[model samples]
Target chain A: MEENKKTCLHDKHVALGALMSPFGGFDMPIQYEGIIEEHNAVRNACGIFDVSHMGEVFISGPQADAYVNYIFTNDILSVEPGQCLYGMMLHEHGGTVDDLLVYKRNSNDYLLVINASNIDKDVAWIMKNAEGYDVVIDHRSDELGEIAVQGPLAEEIVQKVLGLSLSHLSFYTFGEFTIYGDKPAIISRTGYTGEDGFEIYTDHESTRRLWDELLAAGAKPCGLGCRDTLRFEVGLPLYGDELDDDITPVESGLSMFVKVDKPEFIGREAIIKQKEEGPKKKVVGLEILDRAIARHGAEVLDADDNVIGTVTTGYRGISVDKSIAMALIDARFAARDTQLKVRVRRKVFPAVVIAKKFYKKSYKK
Target chain B: MSKIYYAETHEYIRVEGNEGYVGITDYAQKALGNVVYVDMPEVGDEFEAGDDFGAIESVKAASDLICPASGEVVEVNDALVDNPRLINEDAMKNWIIKISISDEAELDDLMDLEAYEKYLESNPH
Candidate 1:
């Protein structure tokens, strides 16, 4: 295995006595104070996260828009500059490569924010698929640093601490700002936690200072542990767990982002066929009747102990206070009210098929 | 007076004659963070030594609770069903289960407090 990398805020996390672990090939902080505390803070008040490990690639050229549209599943033509769209990059076989957010800086320039674990693979895939497209694909995973300030009171904290105005920054939109008189930064009103938040992108030095500023301003410094729980509660898909090389976006219940009616794109034919015929497997939510959590890779079985599906992600919810899981199962058993059992360890837990969205998304739509 | 024996998996059994109160150690609870739920085995359920009887779930992860010695569960801590955080507050005071020892000789194979401390020192989490 290669040596794990550290983000610019590694020293800060250590000083805070955070529980550090290897995640996505980086020595990242899993928790600062505790996962439950940080999880509640993001749901109730405000929390700051060191998301510097996320990958960023810039695509710019005369044909950047066309190239990105061809590679991405969402319709980029509908969004204007400074707008963001969430979609997946799929292979010709309709399996997902990675789910990412694309920021339309302009007709010629676009910023693609990808998962940290998929940085190398995503960059290589983009470059390999850029054979005839007139575009410059620059992987900026290391040079740029990112932070997410999320929660209900996130706007208040960002406005008061950063001394920056975000009143006009609506959801899924970003704007460039000059911070501290000279440092230019990109602040986007977007997040993965299904809350009102902002993601700031800047240099490493600026990011370090900004983290300290957020702490001093009374925003809780959270880690990746609660980040997963918070995102899971609202049914947002994680990269490897929910969408992977073997899982297509259509089967992951993300077909809304896959524009089959759009004029020609990669995996369009396969995706269109899947949409017409319906995917063989579909993602659905299950509420376990027992307290045991049916974690990832746990088998979902039918009445006679036949394996019907597998769990993608599961959690004892902090906000909802219930044992819930999302599983990819046979499409025939994806309907609500269907009875299924999850094998957790040596025991099988009875669960009922429910809406995959355990908690309602509170995005400012 | 009760004699406490520790397992390498961090479970502790406080034995008083033929009865043993089984619970996780302070070290285990501290490592598990907030204890959200404790899946306890029902009374009269038999378990062999090192058998996984239940699980202790935290906000981030879940750990299986293994039996330290072969026994039959006589009582379970019903309080943990609603307030599992009691384990985090005080692991020893809030024992998870009470078992009637089926094999008292198994205690000889377990570690004492002194030996458990040494075992903990050799391994760091």
Candidate 2:
């Protein structure tokens, strides 16, 4: 493959002594201080991450709500102004095309944040299915960028740096905020990691300034390597891993987003059918019995040596003190405490099924 | 006296007076990126030099530890369980295992510090 692309903060990453690597068609920092150190920084204090590579699509026009509800698996009509809803964009066959969060800035304009690698395909899918809809879906990936400020003390640091008060910012809410005098930013109380955080969307040139400002305010710069580890520990689903084109939100235990009770939506009938008849397979969490890791594509086998499923994402849980993984297994064996074996390289290590979440999300009251 | 030998799988053993210390070289640890876990051998395990002894797991991958010399394990550094980083800190000082070398002649087949350093440069992981 060609070398991965670079983000707006590519030069800043190198100057901060980051280890560079390729991710999602971008040459990104795998770590700044190191994976463990950065991971700990975000868990304990606050960390600033250059997530500019995340794609943003602007969907507008009078028929925005109709277009969004038809494409995503959620009740787009229910999202209030200045609110965001998390859901999956499903294919006609009911499998996940991409998992995204659509922010309804108002009745007419909305923003969709999607996984970087799926941006092109997602736009293509939306446009292809947009027949007869009086709406415009514009790809704004290059026009704007994003940064995530996350951790326990993140809110205080954010208020201090941005000169704004977050006194009553409810979870999953967003607002138009000003930073650096004239630069405009959309601040959303959202994050992939199960922590207190905000995603700041701003113009491309202004993103680097915000990154430097946040860093100078004492927020440690983190990278995707620790970001993956952090999100894995929190048991978040990744697009290419715990989810994919062949995986449906219902089978992945995300039926909460696929509301069949809504008037009507894409993948609704298929999801309801699966709900009634039961899914063929389910995504499950695996806790390794030992230190041996179960990596992506590792086989999951039963006691009879029958192949049941494959590991999608695996990592060393710094807090849990053992290897953890998420695997999509036969529904019969998806229950917690089910005994299984993970084929790690040449060895078949024992594992056990557990709750869907590897770690609990401690949402602030 | 001192003698050195290596397993074809890239582990080194330094033998001295019926005893030897075992560890992967600096090159091996560097190749394994961010060591996370080191499964240590027990205090008393008998094994041939080329047998599968333990494992070293990094965030990116895992490699089996091969006995570099024929010996009975006398002691194992259990500290590496939580802090496998001891491997990267000082692979030689923080020996993974102490073994009672069963044979002295096996030392003649291994590389010395100079040869092993050259061996690492000549080959890449």
Per-candidate local distance difference test: 0.93, 0.83
In candidate 2, stretches whose alpha carbon ends up further than 4 angstroms from where it belongs are B3-22, B27-34, B39-55, B63-83, B94-125
Candidate 2: RMSD to truth: 3.8
Tens digit of per-residue lDDT, candidate 2, span A53-94: 899998999888888888888777877898888999987668
**Which lDDT value does model 2 have at A55?**
92
Question: What is candidate 2's DockQ?
Answer: 0.34
Most accurate candidate by lDDT: 1
- Residues A207-282, model 1: lDDT tens digits: 9988998889889999999999999999999988989998899999999999988897889999988888999999
Residue-level lDDT for B33 in candidate 1: 95
Give the runs in model 1 whose Cα sits over 4 Å from its true position. none
For the second chain of model 2, what is the TM-score against the true structure's chain B?
0.88
**Model 2 chain A poorest 10 in a row by lDDT:** A356-365
* Candidate 2 C-alpha lDDT tens digits along B2-97: 666665566878677788988887777766667887766678888886787888877755688988778899988778766788888877666788
lDDT of 1 at A231: 93
Tell me how each candidate scores on DockQ against the true complex: 0.77, 0.34
**RMSD (Cα, Å) of model 1:** 1.6
